[model samples]
Target: MSKKIREKKSTLFSLLFIAAVILLTLWSLSRAEDPDKLIKDIQNASPVFLVLAVLCVLAFICLQGVVIWLQCRSLKLQESLWRCVLVAFHGYFYCSITPMQSGGPPIQIYDLKKEGIHISVGTLIILMETFLFKVVLVILSLGMLLFGHRLMRRYIWPGLFFFILGTILTCGIVVLIYLSMFHSGLLRRLILWLFRKLEKHHLVRSKKGRVEKLISAMDKYRAAAGYFRNQRKLAVLLLAVTMLQRLAYFSTTYFIYRSFGLYGVSYWTIVLLQAAISICADMLPIPGGVGITEALFQVFFRDIFGTMTIPGLCLSRGITFYAQLLFCGIFSIAARVAFRVDKSRLGFFQTSFIVPEDAP
Candidate 1:
């Protein structure tokens, strides 16, 4: 199958995967002996806690978009904060749909391009956003492993090892491949290999017609990365901001737990699990890996959290993921409408080949 065709076909597999996860999670929840207790637990949750969750969630959504916005601006592409937020939300909305959850950014770029953004810049925005997020994940996962060694030994060593090994392997590959992109077809070959694997897995199939498109896009990415490479200071600043943004996200969860009058048992362990879950979800091809993430959270925290764990997990997930999904959608709709997006001028939807600052 053509790469695009294969990639497209993976959507179905992702849907099925998500369905399975949902079923398993529900069954697990049902067996909780006190499934009814969760509702009461939620009812008993502090309103202040809920409010704090929402606010922090909103901040996370904004920072998520802004991290990319800053990267775009660094590249001399400019989109309004409203535009950036819209892009981010619409991406999440799409992510919420498929298991392999990585499709949203490309969709966002496609949409943004229709709004008149340059395709190259849109691609850059998405690439930097993704790259920086991965880097931060590696950093955060490492920190938790180091500081929470005690808990890691008892509750999370297997998962932590899985995550750490995966992180190292993935980062090493990305670094080797991306750097090679500018020098030769080596990086392009790596992309093909990766995509081919996805295709083999029915994630993204091979598309002969798309070879040129994909290669050209990679060239643009290489160019953009080269530009960003020259700006060491900008790179540092962007990294710092993205790091802070992720830290803030974790802290929000921390405060939410705190507000619940709950304490102890390695909240940081939950944090690592969350990081690992998100990474795993990317491979699942389910939009945002919704069902998988929830299930994994329940499973991973089972030992640490006991019976009310699912509810706590759900409550936390509800306030965070669902909240971001909703808020970003509303914000994007309002912003797109207020800004008067001209579809024809922008181009319909397609993957971004560059950062999105040039969109509109």
Candidate 2:
């Protein structure tokens, strides 16, 4: 396809995705048993706690940007913190609209390319970030599942199947990444073996060219992995930042619980419950896990929120997901425009080649 045609199609798809997210948000709002009562309750929520909840979300975004910036710095790249934060907002915008959050990393790599970061290096950064986040999330969820068994049995019993599925999927991805990093040859052999089987069944064409490209990509990936393996301090720093980022996000639920003026539940309880909800939501193939997330919130916290369950859902989902969608969407567009203008003023040429010495 022509370049301009491809750009237009991408823009069209993004607009359609945004529209779908808006409709889903509205549908979730309509699910409240009493719309008027829900509105009243939300309006009456403590502004102080709501603002804190919003700050937690901001922290989540900023911390992710910090992680990216740190990764770039570790590689001796000279990118600024603000620019990296914009990259994080860009990621959040796409992730919230796409199913399984699958569209974010590729688009983020494109954004990073515009920033003069090579695609392979950007891919490695994203891979490490994802790996750390999932590892932390699994650790936290497992802790909650083991210690808070009664809590899970009491409230989240119905959704136990989803929690298990999400755990398996998350762990599977982590294992695949580990293999790609430490056992690239074995992984390459396994993948090519599978590809040849499909080829034999006449399921694929142009096997030679595609296989060559795949091998090249895996070589770069393996090189990047070696960089991380050698930088133990940077790896540990990234893990710490990832854990804080996740906790900042999970804390949003606790702040929302406080906003409702109901005070019996401990902060730890609310945070762990939110963590459990996140585990169940992570592997679902829904856009932003919208419907499933809301349903799980209602199922898990129905007793804790008492009669205010629907209102809490509205407020919590509104701030964390819908409001975030709006903010990140606008920020992504503004940042893209700013980038284009800056590029135009600088009159720089785009360089797509990666220097061997600069690899990783």
Candidate 3:
């Protein structure tokens, strides 16, 4: 772990990452089916219907912004909920376009900093919000897997048990490490000993450090079980947000199917359709899930569409993916320009920024 060896390892890793990026870029471009057809699919959306869909998406983004703002305020930021919502919209617009579902926070952080929030607080809020979001997603996913989806309902009881056990075990390990390494003197001594050795090899430097500064700031209101520690309540609220998101979308799909003359589709059918489409689209990993999502809807609804599979699939996918993505990008541009969000581009979380010494 000397400087020379570290340099060599870094170079090797960089080369590997670059090679992987090149492969992915190529694989993605080569998979593009037809430019004209994609255009048609997006344009196939009626202007009026598309406008309505866009409004729904806007509402979705605003709700997310509000929740994030509330969370930040609870964490002691002085930003308005409305401003936060606009930032959220801009962030989602970017995350939607990029792979790994990243983007949204850094831009908002920069904007908020201009409005007087310390950059460090902005960064902290993003991390906290993301942690809450993920916790909610996992809980909701577990619920859906247990009782919501028919496929899951059949085989997932045992799977559910195992999943819960796995989650608990993971949490136990993490808590153990946190308690032992950071909060316990004996464990802290062991960690420091290791760090010194590693430091000699130029791996980790500065054994004497107050790592708890970050942890204590986040746990600022732990005595009152302030917002940061109320993960369960936050998870519930975020679960509601997550459910609203899924419900609005599936309901829209049901309406779209009706518009297309597929009558009498049940509530469960919509859930099934949305779940199947989402699971498949997520696996694709392409920005917006593009071709993968469309193909999924088509395959899932093939029975309903009969021989008109392609158009039927495109119709559903259009409402969910291409159309929504286009509207998000357009609205994002409008919101950014209208509200003067800096950078014109942003991401999910702010990784670095300044902080007032006494803010926390």
Candidate 4:
């Protein structure tokens, strides 16, 4: 296909997906029972807890930036913390809008390119971030499931199927990443086999150039993986930071739980339930997992919040997802504008910052 035709089709698909997300959002809102009571509960919610919830969201965003910034710095790249934060917001904005966050990494790589980071390096950074995030989430979710089995049975029994499926899918992704990084030969052979099978079935045009490009990308990814292999301490530090990042986001629900003035449920219990909800929601191919996340939240927290479930849902989704979407959208736009202005004045040049295969 011609480049212009491909672009047009992509745009059309994005528009349709956005329209679907809007409809889903409306449907989710329609599921809320007793708007009057929801509003009353909101009115009576503690302002302090609400503020803390907002801060937790902010921390989540900023800490992700910290992770990115630290990665860049570790590689001797000169990325400012503020710019990294903008990149983080840019990622969140695209991820929220696209199915299963499929758009986030490409746009984020583009954003990093504008900062003079090479495409391979940006891809490596994103891959590392994703690997750590998934690993942390899976570990935490499994631990919760083991220790909090009773809680899971009581609150999330209905969604057990989804929880299990999500866990398996998440583990599959982690294993794939590990194989791609450490066992590239096997992954390459598997990929080539699949490609040949597809080509034989006439599913894809026999594009030798595409295969060459894929091989080239994999070689670069393996080279980037070497950096982590040598820098074990940095790897550990990033993993620790990732754990804190996940916890910061998970804590939002607990604060929202407190905001409703309901008690008897411990903080860790709420955090674990939120973690479970995320595990179930992450694998769904929905934009921001909008309807599904809200539904899961209502299902899991119904007993805990009792009559205030709807209000808690409103507050939680509003602050975490909708508000986040708005703020990240603005930040991403601002980042784009800044990049353009800088390019106009400085004459932007593409530069490659390849990580050395054997660096100290």
Better candidate number, 1 or 3, judged by lDDT: 1
Clashing pairs in 4: none
Residue 220 miss distance in model 1 (angstroms): 4.7
Q: Which stretches of candidate 2 lie over 4 Å from their true place?
A: 1-32, 187-218, 338-360
Q: What is the lDDT of candidate 3?
A: 0.52
Error in Å for residue 205 of model 4: 9.7
Q: Give the per-residue lDDT of model 2 (tens digit) for 244-306.
A: 999899898888888888898888788878888888887677767877888899899998999
In candidate 3 the C-alpha lDDT for residue 30 amounts to: 35
Tens digits of per-residue lDDT for model 3 on 23-99? 56336533543546545644554555545554555566676677767656554555567677767766765555554
Instruction: Highest lDDT: give the candidate number.
Output: 4
What are the clash counts of all predictions, listed in order?
35, 0, 6, 0
TM-score of each: 0.73, 0.84, 0.59, 0.84
lDDT of 1 by residue, 1-360 (tens): 898798657656755655676567668776764767777777877888778767866776677678766765565444566677677777766576564455677777775566565565566667666667667776766666678577667655656544566567547745653455334356668876887788789887667777677777676766666666677787688788777676656655555565557778565655666666554444544466566566666666677566567667767677766666667667657755654455433322222454333433
Error of 1 at 24 (Å): 5.0
Candidate 4 regions exceeding 4 Å error are 1-32, 187-218, 340-360
Clashing pairs in 3: 91-104, 103-347, 103-348, 104-347, 104-348, 105-347
lDDT of 1 at 236: 84
